[model samples]
Target: MKETGQFEVYVEVLRAVIIAVIFLFLLWSDRKNDLKSWDGWRYILNGFFFLTFATTIDITDNYPSLSKFYIIGPTVLEAILEKIVGYLLGSILLALGFFKFVPLIADYRREAEARRKAEEFSKNILSSVDEGFIIIDENYRILSANRAFLESAGVEFTEAVGKKCYAVSHHSEKPCYESGEECAVMHTFQTGKPHNVLHKHISSDGSPYYVEIKSYPFSRENGRVKSVIEVLNDVTEKRQLEEQLAHSQKLEAVGQLAGGIAHDFNNIVTAIMGYAKLIKKKNASIEEAKKYAEQILLVAEKANSLTKSLLIFSRKGTLEVMPISVNDIILGMSELFRVVVGRKIELETDLLDEDIMIMADKGQIEQILLNLISNAKDAMPKGGKIKIKTAFAKLGETFIKVHNLEPAERYALITVSDEGEGMDDETKARIFEPFFTTKPVGKGTGLGLSMVYGIVKQHKGYIKVESKKGIGSKFYIYFPETNEMPIGMDDSTDKFFSGNGEKILLAEDDNHIRRLMENCLTDYGYKVVVASNGNEAVKVFCENDDIELAVIDYIMPEKDGLEASKEIKKINPNVKILFLSGFSDNNIEREINDEIKNAELLTKPILPERLLNKVREILSKEKELTSLDSDKLH
Candidate 1:
């Protein structure tokens, strides 16, 4: 029994030692893992309880006195109590371990799910945005890109991943910063602040596009910049529209200037032309004097055409689309070109043997020649030669596409080439844009090329410019060739007629013009009734009941020509009236009443002969109508 008791004690000692060792190992392992958690402490507490129980059992069995201390209770009850205490302690320890570890596992699962949700939300937001979004790391490598970014860059996920941002965006081997371009991403990274810049990017198809880029610094938890988030917005069309609006405003400003000059200049031209005609008529018998007077009249008519061109440029004139000979126009302006370009510059023309006929406004066509020559002259300040040539061309599909013209059309090709300091690609690109000029401020209105472009388009034509820096420039204007006969080509007949003993009413604002018209009318043997303005003309017309015809200026101080004509028509429904204007027919139509009848339009500056002939024609028609009415009454 003693040996057995000693063996049992040894067994308990070994068990206690093993329990202690296991507890120590668990504690050391927990500490190694840096886990000072409540679960680890609970594990140590359970181990300690088991070790203490083992020690207590060994001590009680070894000492009979300690055993007898529990002898007060029944032996069976004592044994039961011992077992119950052991079981209850084990249960408590197990419950504590369960409580400690289970909640930790649940919390870990919840945190993992929440993190997943956050990542998904971030990806969804990035993908749904319209503007291109890209994330780049500090090494300038693409970390991630959204759908918009991928679509804009024209690359797929597999292709874009692991590529450098600069390589993907600009196809550059180095970063944009290294290439001397403004780099928003680099700026954001260096400053740890957002940056914005406008950059020109080339698309996948090698087309140049403009983009506004905004780069925001993406920071780590420790507040260090880790990456950059770039937002790219395509602004190419926006920039173009802004430029167009600015050009339109500039054209408006120039139109106002042209309109004011034209109004004042027309009166001067009318007086000059009238006096020249009067001089020719007075010196008709003397051949030498008559020749000089005829020369003066010709020059005055040319000046009148120039004033008409100013009105046309202002968009206040109508387009008179008649069949015109381009060669005749060029030849007619040769002397003027020489005078305008000076003696240092040489003017040359290569006309076709046959005239190239085109349906266009003669004055606007002249304006086009003037503008092109003027531009050429400015280019050759040090003196160079300009050559004007004409040819007939059958434009093919390729030419039509390049020139934005109708496919497979015939055009009268007018080429104006100059040997002068030419322009670069950038300048040539914007040459036809309004308010774009290389001339110094106040030297050029910048509307010359724009006007030429407008006129060409208005006449169903196209213009192309070819130029190289330090070389020369060539402008090719193409007008659709026509087969119709040219108007005003038959000028051999007499344009003058002596007016019968008939009364005429003339309304003019300028005193000199009014006097010239009065003298011209009286010299043509017509009874003249003069008025300074539209209101005065109406008064004079009502007083003279037998007035044969009324010629009225469209624009006047009080009550314009249309209003005066309306008042005159109320008095006599069959009254003959003619509307004269310094402005074009389109501009006159805007102010004139369409209801006015028995009215004809005549544009100024009208020659004295044409005016007399028109009056005679109208009177002759009125006389035939009166004779028919008298026959019907009899």
Candidate 2:
């Protein structure tokens, strides 16, 4: 609205100032770009600068006092040149600059959009997962965390980001490695590969829980791990469930075994009762009574054998573990094997020439052969070849995993192959299950193979079977090999059973067995002193200075055989001990093998002659026991 000359001059000066500001801003924006890409920015900036200079010259033309320039010419002379060079040239440069910049702007917009969407997609996926996911840099700093991770950590995004990953997840001042916990993330960074491990982590609420932590590493151009992505899965419930299932299966198996044992005992009792009645009713002669008595003793021995079998199957009894040759057991059972298989079947043995010795129960090993051969004989009613082989095996990775055995180098492999009716995959899979058998209900107790399995497992051995429906079956048993020499099989001895008036202290809780043993020892020219319990036995041994031997039962009411033996040895380390046990505990067996150097273990229900022979053996081995004491002292 102002028509004054002064107002017009002020408006022109303001327009030139605005153009000059725009030119400076454009040059600042192009500073970050490459020199080659500066062509478009150069044009736009120069246009603004020219336009501003031309307007300035025009504004100066209003004031004729100060209208001069060095880069151009006098204000009056450049008035025409200002329109051509400043306005026209500036407009042309801006038009060309915008033309070149158009495609560049469009490309920037498209690339920016693609990156944003990719980030959004990744966020959605991580947030939706149930497992906690996080990306952490090599410095242990948390770069990014998903919604799942934030919630699990019981913290907000502000609380977690940029903080050390161990600080958030472990709630610790130091890394997991410092706390004796192997950090999967750190392991991956160092190894340059994925790592997984079981980790105990603290939740946001500070409760401890177990997680399976999986970590992956990302490398840079220099092949160094730059960052790690970790996924955490809680597995606390799965491990608990597995333990409960195993316990339940064990209880069920015990119940089934008890029932089977009860039924078998009832059959044995009936036989004994029938034989007793026959002997009582027989009035023919002393010879007839003697024959009936022998029959009764034979049936009673069967009951004792049954008791031993029960002990082995239940895995509660002790094993007289000794280094025994596998070839010897197989050969020893050959006669019994032939009788059981009959003339219709052919039995062959392929034993290794080199002795393969393992620490195991000799009787248990014999039982294994008997059970397997019996199983094979039953499978082939029409008679077939049964082959037993023994060898030294390496027990490599595959064998160890298949049998779930501890990693070891040497194993004694015993293979029993039968050319008989075999089992299918389904039947073979559960063959080791207790109370599982293909035989008819009344035909088999289903405990034979199970007993073998229990014995093998108790020995820290493994058994596996391969079978085909119409073909045949092969069973492989592996026992850890030992360097110890095989036990001597020689039964002949020159030592006499009768003692030379040597005093013996016999301790047994059983009235009948103890009295019989005392009389048996006394009759053999030995002075026998008896004690009812282990406490009394210890007292009597202390009273009698000339007691040559102390025989005590393994399991007693007040004090056990092991304890009494320890006390006796403390008094006289040179005295020999003979331990008799009806129900031998595994701990006692281990003590006899390891700590008790002056003692020998003898299983109970032993014949009177055998008991006398054992006492004589221990008494005669005084020099031997003294030698052991000297060796142990050294």
Candidate 3:
């Protein structure tokens, strides 16, 4: 019995040692993990307590005297009872630990996987964004940058990391705050609030671009600003498009203004030219009287030219491009410009001695001149000198680049300078913008420079302006030079073409213009029947069967020239019709029907001589046709 009890004690000792060893191994394995967790440590503690209890029962069973000294129960019963309690406690602890730790481990694994996916998603969002994005720490050091930011900075990710934000964007050694430039990121970091700013960034290629920067603050839980997230949007093209739209609107406004005044001005010019021509023709025998009449004719022609310039400036006239002498235009306008600038202002010219030819509309070129002179006159409110100069320029690559001109071209340069209050840089930049003016309301239309700019562009030319605030302003206009010969003036006007006693119908809207036309035509020996408008012209044509031809003004109250011509053609198919317009040929073509045959179109303020010659030519053609028809009848 003694031997058996000793063997049992040894077996219990071995069992206790095995349990202790297994529990210790579990603790060691979980040491690197969250062993502080009750689930991990409680199982080991329970197993240790159970091992202690079992070993105590085993030693007591072997020595009954020690058991009696420690407890009043029988050794065998105490040992069995202890074993059952300890085993139950150990099993419960092990089961509780397994249940708690299994779910906790699964949750931990799931959380780790989700965190990884979130990081990947954030990276994808940053990479796919179109605008440049960057993250910088409070110290302005770049912590992270997206692909767009990397490209905009002209650097790789490796190079951008750890660099200063200002160094990367502004190419500076210090922060933008130190340089006096408003830094959105720095502000965001300092105030822990969002900030926005517009910055002009110089690219690596030495070109400048505009960007709108919006920055958001990244803060800690305690509301301490940790970093800033910057969003950069390029806005250069958007700003340019806005400027272009504004310019177009201004041009349209000015064009409308020009169109409104065109008809009345053309009528006045027609009356003046007609009366002057009649005076010159009637006084040809008196040399002095003829000379005075010729001067009146010259002034009338200049007025007519001015009217044409207004039409061109309004973009309401067709371009009549031909080789023209620039000097003649400038010299002819010299007296008018002097008068316009007033006696306070002195007008001077430095024209090229030799003629400089250019392929351009004569009226459009004159418009350019008039606009520039008018602008100069306005600049000098008090009294100043206005200088008009002309020179031939050979433009090369360097010159073209500096002046923003076409490459490898020759230009006829006309410079108009003023000794007046000049403009600042900002004002000079927008001088050619339509409706942009420094002059007060009603004092200026702000369309002069804009019209000049449009006319120059239409003629395939360029304008450059130089101004100093207190000094003066200078405008340089460059027209592409031409080698083609200019058209010679017609001296046929020295002799008048007298009309035979042929019945003619005339239509005019203006009373003065109509009376002048009647006197001129009657003096030339044509029996003239006058009408006030297109409807009257049609009526006159139907009532007067012997009328050889009809002259109709394009724009009238009741019916336009085109409608009257159509009606007259129906009444007399063989009658000759001459259509006169104050507007451009393009506008007339668009208004007139294409079916009207044996019809002629002329632009007004027509010279009296040209009118008579056209009438005579058309009448002769009609007579020839009539004679052909007569011979056919015979």
Candidate 4:
């Protein structure tokens, strides 16, 4: 293959050129998708080395022939290969460096977007919260304040940013930490923990505010305290509500105690009054003795009134419901009211034109009026005018808003007004609470208005109070109105009639009660037979077949009043039955059927006069029954 040196050199040069071109093509042939980072760059570098090695071998094998032409011809192939190798190496190194570090650039972009979103969320939370917030640096300088905090402090947020906390708030000459009285922010920074404190702050209007502050330490990376974040809350209204709840609970407990004692005392007073009346009647000829008995009775009656007042305060008294004209009740109490109010305080009355009937217990209603009148008189101790007015009232929407009730159909409006020093809003709010009195101890029990409130509520009524500090007070009692008339004895006439010889059967559980009834009826000229139990009374009546009246204790043992009444009616349907018991009217009426309820009811500890009147009335009516019975017998 060796020929002339120059020819050989020329062949080598051509071969080197071919090798260099092939290597360049190989690098260009590696496409964008085929470029596998550093590994693909390494393959391109190895191809350049192989081309250089082939060019060196061609130049070495034809050295003498290439030197004959020129010194450059001999190494020309080597020099070209060397240049190609150097350029390929530099390109491979640049590609490998870019591929290795490009991932860090993508990560930096992702982190920048996340940080932007977090900052936006933080800004939204700070702007919208109702409560105030403040952040302070470790040196006790304000770092930031929210809109709420700035508004509450009466300053612009920008103006407060770099000011010391105490300078802007308390107007202190130095920082709160330097003054050293346990500032919440300073404490949080010092301990690197949270500090909670309740404090008073004066608002822009000079009104005091109760605020709760929670401060937590904001720490740096090296565990050093940097700042404090504080959250503020206004608790003024909440504190007032708690105080009101406590006052209400105190009144309730006192009412319960007072009511329990009153209930028990009522029974004792009833017994005392009954025995005293008996004494007075029996000792009529002994004038001094009779007078003493009557005096005792009077004292006991007064005590009964007091007990009734206590029961009303406790809301424990049972109401004896009856239908009565409001006009009549007012008329009945007017004279008594005038006497109590006396000459110093002027008394005024306004009665409705039309008769207004209401279903209520008469004694309770009377007591309610009397208490209000007494309170009015006391309010006007220096002798002012007192007015009592009654009318038909229908509640309106405006009334409902003030009184917290739905508008009602009709009401019996009773307004009691006095020209005396009135109450404030605070006093008015608590006036109806039991045992809450402005008067000194022993002067008032503070139960007057509370009792009024309880009774009115129990009757499905509402009351409103209006008063000013210097002007007088007016109390409006709105009692529900009814059209039904009251059915009961009229005690206006004191006349007692001797009975017309009608036979009667009296059934009583208590021996004393039985004796009292028998004596009262026997004195009135009626043939009276006494039975201890309902069973005995029923058996005796069935055996005799001549009983005209059957009076049975509704709650008695050994055949109750209702059962005995049914049996007696079976024997003689014409027999009149009267139920007597101390139990509640509801308990008796609830268990009894409608057919048996037609029997007249008499609650026990029966008044002697009431007993006599009922007996006389029954016998007078039985005269019509006797003829009917005679017809049936024939």
Could you tell me every candidate's TM-score relative to the true structure? 0.55, 0.56, 0.52, 0.47
Better of 1 and 4 by TM-score: 1
Clashes of 2: 0
lDDT of 4 by residue, 1-634 (tens): 3667557767767866866785576557554435445444555465456544544544334354455545454465745655566566545544654654466457667889889989888877887886788888976788998877887777898889998877876678886557655578877877888998887767667998788888988655478689889888788998889889998977775665566456547766676776566666754567766665666656565565565556655665567688888788889988999998989999888888988888887777888898789888888879989888998888887876676653457888989999988889999999998777787655576777888887787676788889887789999988778767678787633555677677788888888878988898888888887778878988778666677788788867798778888888988887888777664455566665475745777764466677877766776677767778899999
State model 4's lDDT.
0.75
Per-residue lDDT tens digits for candidate 2, residues 15-89, read: 568667765756665575565456678778877777766666653453443343224666555566756778886
How many residue pairs collide in each prediction?
Answer: 0, 0, 0, 1
lDDT at 611 for candidate 2?
Answer: 84
RMSD (Å) of each candidate, 1 decimal: 18.2, 10.5, 18.4, 20.4
lDDT of 1 by residue, 225-330 (tens): 8988989999999999999998998677667556645654676567666656665675455766566566666667667666565555566656768888999899
Give the clashing residue pairs of candidate 1, or none.
none
How does model 3 score by TM-score?
0.52
Alpha-carbon lDDT of model 1: 0.80
Clashing pairs in 3: none
What lDDT is reached at residue 157 by model 3? Answer: 97
The parts of candidate 2 lying over 4 Å away from their true place are: 1-130, 133-190, 193-196, 199-210, 218-230, 256-266, 269-421, 424-468, 471-547, 552-564, 579-596, 603-607, 623-634
Count: clashes, candidate 4: 1
TM for candidate 2 is 0.56
- Pick the lDDT winner: 2
Residue 610 local lDDT, model 3? 73
